[model samples]
Target: MIAVVYSGSHYAHWRLADRGKTVASFRTSGINPYFNDEKQITTLLNKNINLIHHAEQIKRIYFFGPGLASNELKDIIRNAFLTFFKFAKITVAHDIDAVAIASCKNTEGIVCICGSGTNAAWYDGKK
Candidate 1:
């Protein structure tokens, strides 16, 4: 099973997949205004635990977010995943990768995600 987790400006979302097929999904509101705050971090951890509880078959998790580029945020997220689901293999993915993949279907151009944050990049097809 594979889990894809993401956080937006107002909420966080997660998708669970088994054998390339999505099996379950979850979402929750963002509570903290700042990403570094302990309370807000705890809220994210709780949400992850809740999501994992519902998808016990998940064996690996692919985390996606903008703030994940920061080492501090990465540590926090890594710790949270370990605390909740120790057995699952966790991998952090840049938000840009998601944008690139989504845009690839259209053949070329700029793909922008203007939600809680913004990201843009050009793909030459060499990827």
Candidate 2:
């Protein structure tokens, strides 16, 4: 099973898939490592019924969100997810990387992200 998450400042969108099919889709309160601690993140995870039901079954998680540009910030999310999804491998990255990959992929291009804030990056086919 795999899970993909995109988190902004206000909410998180989640999709769980297994055997190439979607199993569950839901949203949870936004989790910003910059503003929320491990305990708070864990609490948020615990509050979600879908997560509580599928946490153990998930094998991999790809998490992308804002404010995760630094290793310290990334570690905060890594730790929280590691503890919650015991059986899953968690990969955390900045939202900008997500935008670059989704929009540019392997093509050299400039990607602009406008959300709670605006930013842009140049992708040379690979980061």
lDDT of 2 by residue, 1-127 (tens): 9999999978999999999999999999888987899999999999999999999999999999988878999999999999999999999988878888999889999998788878898988888
Predictions: Cα RMSD each: 3.5, 1.0
Candidate 1: tens digits of C-alpha lDDT, residues 1-61: 7778766647668787777787777786642223545455555656565564654566788
Shift in Å, residue 71, candidate 1: 2.6
Model 1, runs deviating above 4 Å: 30-56, 105-109, 124-127
Write down the TM-score of every candidate. 0.72, 0.95
In model 2, the worst 10-residue window by lDDT is 112-121
